[model samples]
Target: MPKNSDITPLPASGPQNKPASAASVAMPADSHSEGGAPTSEIELPDFNDVELNNLISGVKLYLQEHNFTEFSESNLFLMLIHALRTAINTSNDLAVQNICKILINLNEIDHAGFMSLLSKKIDIAPYTGQSFAFTLVDQFYSATITRDTPSLISLNFLFSILLQSDSLFLKQLAELQASGNSEGMFGLLLIAQALLRSSTESLHIMSSELIASLVILILKKNEELINTRLFQPIPHAAFSGQSVLTFLLNVVKCEAQHSNEFNNLLLKQLIEAIHNAPESLVNEGLVRVIKRGPDEGLNAGHIFLQALIASVQIKNNKGVADLQVLLKTLSARAGFNAMLLDNITSGKYMNQSGMSMLVQALMAAKDNEYDLTPIMDVFAQIIAEQGKEKVLSALQQRVKYSSTTYLQLLTNVAKDDSSMTRLLNLLENESSHQETLNPAVNGFFSKTKSEKEAPEEEHKEFTSTHSSSASH
Candidate 1:
């Protein structure tokens, strides 16, 4: 048993957000086939009612008595693990639900105690008899939406515990789901969600490879039960001031850079889910994806951005009447839209494609107020990688869309002494000997060329249209 000194109560306040409700958000009513299979011929094993009831009663009694310290005893823990194992071996839903209820009750009654037990370094090899770890995980999944605790905090804590489970536990969860066991898929998601709650820098190091494997298993088995259940709650939780977006950002980032094709498939399914999903989820999912892999969902990102920007447009399309589209616009107006512009300019996502997306997004942004530092950083990186000339030529076309942007960029460069010196040196060297202008330097003339080369009739036609539009 843990000594009394080691059993301190966890600080009562967590996340400080409202508790997540199981029934608070409504999902699409259709029940997808278990394992998302084309036919329901597959029969998964049912639960053992007697064993499950005993396990639940034991766990609940332990929680109620504040006797988790007893679990610290090697022999007691082994017995508990055995019971949990037997409970999962059964295919009975009520038995599974009862076990879940015990876990949820433990969380509500003694969160600190639960976290303490999870943090204990038990020798998991001997404990792996029937994947007791998976059963414990299933307990968490069953309680996720049903438990009453601070919004993402309790969920985040649950995720942390799952991530620390033995690899065998994770492996078993993956195997069960792969074998078309719908219930086992729940355990996989619990692990996935926990990984999402870890720090971004630490996340890639801790769970990238493992998460890749799990995501692959989910996709290969086409486990819609897990996806529909877990993913559906994200937006609702996020919209109600939860940080599901932040969590997803970590998860998506880990998935994005993996070389595995499974990661790619997961990314694809994730995007489709975003398109048809509710507004809050779409926004949360998009933000996370963009934060991690801005280039992954090119078309979806474009549509999402357009949808976000469209909301801010003075003249919106009457045909697009979805509340999500409307909310995206309103969110844009309230500075939520600024996140796109901010990410683009943040330099955190600097790459050829990232810069390309930034330019495209900026063009779409029109007169939207956004910082240019990220773009400037991107410009510097592009010039360094692709050379100055290519970057300048590209900028030249973009500058015509906004002289204000051009001046701001030039002003930013001039203000930085090192960058200014380089600019002066480049200009001087080119001006000294070149008969033809360098591409980078020629950005100043790009717009001029279009104006000078325009045919008289076409120019007049363009001017007339501008004048007419201006008059209106």
Candidate 2:
């Protein structure tokens, strides 16, 4: 391992000459045709170990002198990339580390340009570029495990670039899984765990992308891998008694407010996983996530509701069923109903689409005889908080298709004076009372009318009894 001093910046001023040995190396003569426009086919030159080392030395000097302006376009830059590739292929860790140090320093100079160049280079020969990237990522995992700060810093700089290109990063993991590279796949998981547990804010920021990618990848694998691997207990101290899935969800809960894309992506994968996996295993995992609650902001419960609403919108019946089961499983927990009610009542979880989905879920629960108490409670609160005008307007929009279900919900929740009054007013103001005259609505009015008359009848009986007693 190189000490910090060993990787220090070169002197501020230096002659910008290629090293003596580097002169022997072949450079692409021109990247443009006779028309003076850049050509699409620029050939990469090969270098032996000695020449590659000299080239790396020269590129290092060039970067120190020029500060990376046009560095990606320079022939020296091309040679540096080839050298790094060769070093990776040859398993030369020292050379790989040195090249990583250069790139890390380059990033400090111009982060955007550095990332742009990295992406282009990866796209040049994706498999080879991925090979190099995987090697660096594995090194990063090792450094993180051993607490090797210097190496971890350099490798994290490289790994962070890979994270920003999530598609490519995921492709690399897919390739590893296809090749039966269990070690490689496991290293990636460990890297995700480490990042999630990292205290450093920047590394922590990168954890969300890595975790989202890992989750998507794991969900795509076979059942054994999904259970034995993703659900296996994490060995880290920070993740005591938690599986990889739980730890990831915990981090996600804290980090979700920072990145909705991550939350949405993971939520989609989890919903799909629930739709596809054996009901018990996936539901168990989800129940555990919900049970732990959020370490901070948005939690798995919120995510579950979001996913459930989305599934309903898409008409993903299997996903909706699985999510509903998970919801029911958590409904009995302390304060679970209140949290859900608060979210829905505050409009945090219910848009027009969300409301329609909730209504649909409520209707299904009624048909299936599942307890609609929690959801009904949520609706009553939404009506109370948002008012009958807004809530009734929202329900009316969905009433055209399922007026029966909509009216049934109105009847079920019209258990109190204020709610019954609002329901009657809403029914009276309807443009057409035909649907409001349905059996359910008539039954609701009859039920309320009978209950109202019972109290008056009881009062008369009480007055007659009192008069009879006085006369006697």
Candidate 3:
């Protein structure tokens, strides 16, 4: 939250962006099992109706006994989810509405807690209605972008669980259908529209909101605005006049049909945010993407590389720096570093400045350090493209002013059998000799000569000793 105002309002859109009707976005298919778990079993305990009834009744009694003092929203969050699942099964519209009312009440009592829990596990189904659902989503966006970490965390978890639970439910239905229950097919068809998608479509709206909140936070000048509590709106040239969530929802939904297009657009938006947004916010978001690991469906590393490559192509200095930070932050990640050699060198994304800065950053990073393989590849490519004189000059400059680590790495690259052979030839051809590079070269290339001379030197001593013995 900026110091101006901690409140941001996410305005409602027309019928096109309706939350319950998220079927428009065409989310990826559900391949996993129930509750979004990969297996058939759900993570949550299986509660029969009687047990659910007792639990709900117990909660009601507890609340009544305490004179309706609202319990901790976090504590009641899972309880509400359990109750709502029962409500979904009962198919009683009134019960669903009542559950919705409790959620709203929780929000009213503790907006932070409700927003936190809503961000985490609260589910609003048919009861909230399409319009109401959109409003709730808007509120979610507003609450999330405030940069309140606790609230944002809850909100983030909310959208994720929305997809997971809906996926799980769909998987269960799929398994049931596979079981060959033709008799119930007609009944399922009637409710299929409501049951099939569940909250997935709404989750896109949430995704849109999440992106918007981040954009808002990024547009603020104060780097530490997230930790502040002032209220601020989305004001930036990048966003134009429209708010973050609304625009992204509209654009992403329209482009949903195009597979990589959507992902590309998403990546572009994140890079844009990183260039203009708060470092902390951009960093936190990138870390999450990187942490998602490289899976087949969506690869965070690929997304990161795309961003870095774009930054280099456009010569966005800040963007490149942010990317460097990203790599350094995740440097120790073997999987990420394993791909850096190809990610950086395979494409001509880095010019002289970009490549040099990247190499220096990787070699110089204090945290999340990377191995020499990627570092070696970077300088090797630089030497090949920019010539040995250019790389040697850079190394000489680093040794002159900065640390020797850069100098040492450059020497290591030059000393490699693959790189050294060419580098030595290039230097010999150009006749550009540096005194600093001499001893390192002598130290490295002398290994074979030293090995070959050891036996001869020993033999000479043995022959001398034998001749002296014979004379004696």
Candidate 4:
């Protein structure tokens, strides 16, 4: 919240003194005298001088006191532009840096208006405009490394402007990535990280685009950069508490218009995180990502199922439990049942052990009161396609080594008398089925049999009643 004046001014002569003659630059045509005659050009100060800084300060003060619309047409804008051009031509880093501060202040006053005007002005000279932008980027990198918040905010504003206005800026960034410039790459990551962490609304809007672009660029050049740098924990204390993973997930959540290539990169990263990171981080991260619902280009449900399968494959109980939390959300989506059926029936998850894990997950979802109709439908489809015998045989094998959760799931999926009888007969064939089965499993089987027989009993009674009526 510090004002621009808080920054230490550059060592220069008093504001009352004009720049030396050699440092003077021509004013724009609009700045001519009242009679339409050319006036003396303004004195563009040296890097060490304060005249340009004073002019910028004057503009800042005027903007603070009056409407920015008034300043757009004012004489001060033309003078500031001429001075800015001179600084750009001379590559006077100091003056340009101060101008960045002024731009940041103007942006604070009216973000959209000032940015539009700035973009228009920069478009006048593409090459010089890019040069000016690059200077700001360099300054931004410098401020980033030094943890200069004020300057970072200012320079980042300019950087965002460049991103919005110049297409080549991104190309240059890709070039930087391709060249193996670690410093450049890291700076981009840090800037992006900083932008996401920023509380500013405009910064938030630009940050998503910035992150998407950087991720796409990194994904294209080397995915390893994402793992090593972008995903690495930020060293700054301010960002120490933030998660880059969550930021990326937010991008997925908030911006759905990204190309499939971008969405694929994000999905890949999430899957990698789930597979490699600690169980806690993976579990929590997946829940949030799945809740955000990544773009349809990549199936969030598939991602969830993959993580669920991995958790089961490794016997990570915590992972499985965490994923069960998302069952309802994933199940609510259309075609989710079909997707789950395909995944559980075809991949590594299709095996006895994998199916057992999925069964347990579904059973837990049922116990939690999450609607398992979709999952039950999947189970039915599996039985119909893969044969009830094959499905029963797999569950029978898993029941021997795992918990009775599979038995509970079997009870739910075996909706018909024949399917229930087949599963019970399979369990009965096990010599130790009685001793090994928990009360829950036994209860599930007993309840399933009675429920299946009730309708048959009612039909038999109806038949007897009709016969009695006819005899009468």
Candidate 5:
């Protein structure tokens, strides 16, 4: 083994020559005394070597001594250079293990120079090369600015390195994902941040590949990390530059069925990113990243509707209105109204607790003054298209759609002082008018139960009639 010039008497790997504590070695080189070796006589490994364990403590001490100033950079780099070389020269299990231990221990320190050196030396095969590469990337990420500009630039070099190593990096990332190794996947995200940094135009040029890679990450790998706060900044970064945002928007607009949780989270984040995103991202080309699963088929339209509903629930008035318009565009483009009618009439979401969530969002959207007329128009159009039978079927499936609630809702609609008058008017139209709108309404009002002793069937019939009438 090579000597570490800066420090003499480095600790060696494997078992110690003597017991390091009062505990006896279970199997000794020779038969031991029945009781054990004398406690005082048992020698331990050198205290400093054993306590510091590896290069991590030394690197940390150096940073501490320098008050963590830029002047310490060169000295740290020198130490890391030697360590990287030593590990490379040894190139065996012990060396790899030692290097990993050191890197893990140094996780908290700002040691970009060391990370860069390690990244360069990590190309060696049969040594868990990808894990080491990602470790270096992770350290680089840790070194980045959490709240300032200068650090972002300093860390941008790491992005350059990641961009250069994309394929190898992605392959290793996939392996880590398959192995269910979250730490390794976290490192991959440090690399992914680079892709989000590309110019809007550049992203546009490579939108297909970018989206494909994002989908794979969200759907096929590292789900736990995909849902984390760390993943939140990516969409904003991806939309920072105009050219890239436009390109991304166009790509998303063109792709209709991105069905993955990661993509879902990304879509949610993209909606958030719109607040500060370049106009190109919000307006350029087509921008519906929220999509349906394969199982949804025609039923997939509800997914976007749910997303729209969620968007409207935002507390900010401007945001709610903006989203309402955005949703209108999306619904018109994707024909979501028909799907919603199908799900509601089929009672597909009747038992799903998220139905309540939808109601809550709708109530929230109701508070916004953005002429909900268009939204109501879409709702009416859907009913018109699906026929009253489907609409009534959907309402019957929803336990919340009782005759009492519809009556009260009608009363409230008649009393509202807001801009939802048109929707309210539609709902208050007479039973006969509703019949012209949908056959379900016609069938519904045709039956009547006794005043005080209405049969269960009669109650359902009465409720359906009121619900249909309320929508007229």
Candidate 6:
């Protein structure tokens, strides 16, 4: 060290700085004086030849004591890039993670450029070199999408990096879709997750076109899977591609349940997609969504109901199972049945095809006693809303069930002279065959509970067998 030479700044190998407000641990360097000025900061001292030699000698001693070997000057310059390459190639996940942490500190390693470089490395990696953008998606999926896993740190870095270039990521997804490779679908799902997790920050990217493309790719891919007839009949254990489907469903649910309007739109698209899917798959997705409970207060169950109702609008023969799902969904929600009936009365739904579907569902589940009170409530509302005659007429034509069913309901809710006469006639006709139905005639025609309670003590003990028999 005869004379001072130029000093290259140290490579950015420490934690990258964020806004001080975001840092969890503040430093003494960050301390402000009482006047809101930074305190006298410790600055790096410039070195002269003698000082540099002395520092070098001290560092040499430290390295020797620490048993560290130093590489040559040029070798050190290229060591990190070479090491990162080796780690990725050899699948040394730990080394790659640690190296990524180091690279993030380099000021020259801007997010977009670093991610593009990293993608090249991933493309050369044997396991994750898929046509899609997320290089390690296959491995991440193989690890079962768990939070605690080996590739987690690497994948998280990749996702954060990818989130910065949303347009490019979406364009890659489109390419993946066009190629129709299964690995591409896997990548597509992972990219969608990244995009969803990203907020509207500087690094985050979410445009309408990007969102639509992602949704279209997902729906198309899921449709292709269902078309294979693997998951038909819904929720079969024999379904071959569990991971892919699980990933896609999670993506849909995450987007759908977001507070954003765009997210809600995604929910609508998913429902419509499921509706148009194979009937068995539609049923399966609906049942599974219903079981999992709501997310964002707008769970899959609600979307399932929307899909079921929308399906009747389609120009096709809806199978009995689909109709049953529709009916079951309606019955689960309060006041939905009345709405359905209103739609029917107003000629807004249940065409000949739809009515047949519904009738089949009702017949299949006539005796299902899950909620008798709700069922009765529907009938009561139907009678009060559409009138007894329209309700009975619609039921007789649409529901091919027992006249006794309609008659019993009418009697329970019916009143007034004209309505009572109509009920009396229907009751007499249904009972003419030998009183196969007595609850209606006995409960209504005999007397009501109010009549019995009116003069109980004054009239008598009121020990009427009729009241006891009717109740029982």
> Best by lDDT, which number?
2
Q: Write the per-residue lDDT of candidate 6 for residues 63-84, one digit (tens) a residue.
A: 3333211211111212233343
- Give per-residue CA lDDT, model 4, range 151-254, as digits (tens): 44444456565455534444343222211123233344444444334312324344334444544443433333344443344334334323355445444332
C-alpha RMSD of candidate 3: 22.0
Badly placed stretches (over 4 Å) of model 1 are 1-49, 58-93, 100-114, 125-247, 250-351, 366-472
RMSD of each: 18.4, 19.5, 22.0, 18.6, 16.4, 19.7
Q: Model 5 off-target regions past 4 Å?
A: 1-176, 180-316, 332-339, 342-360, 368-370, 384-388, 397-472
Quickly count the clashes in candidate 1.
Answer: 10
Residue-level lDDT tens digits of model 5 in 310-343: 4443344333444355455544532344445333
Local error of candidate 1 at residue 259 (angstroms): 30
Steric overlap count per candidate: 10, 0, 12, 0, 8, 0
Better of 4 and 6 by lDDT: 4
Q: Model 2, 109-210: lDDT tens per residue?
A: 866555444433121232222333344455555444444444544555565554454344434433332222332343445555555554223344344454
Query: How does each model score on lDDT?
Result: 0.36, 0.44, 0.33, 0.41, 0.35, 0.34
Better lDDT candidate (3, 4): 4
**Distance from true position, residue 312, model 2, in Å?**
15
Model 2 weakest 10-residue run by lDDT: 1-10
Superposed on all Cα atoms, model 1 deviates from the true structure by an RMSD in Å of: 18.4
Alpha carbon lDDT at 102, candidate 1: 52
Assess candidate 1 and give its TM-score to the true structure: 0.33
Clashes of 2: 0
Whole-structure CA lDDT of model 4: 0.41
How does residue 115 of candidate 4 score in lDDT? Answer: 39
Q: Give the candidates in order of lDDT, highest first.
A: 2, 4, 1, 5, 6, 3
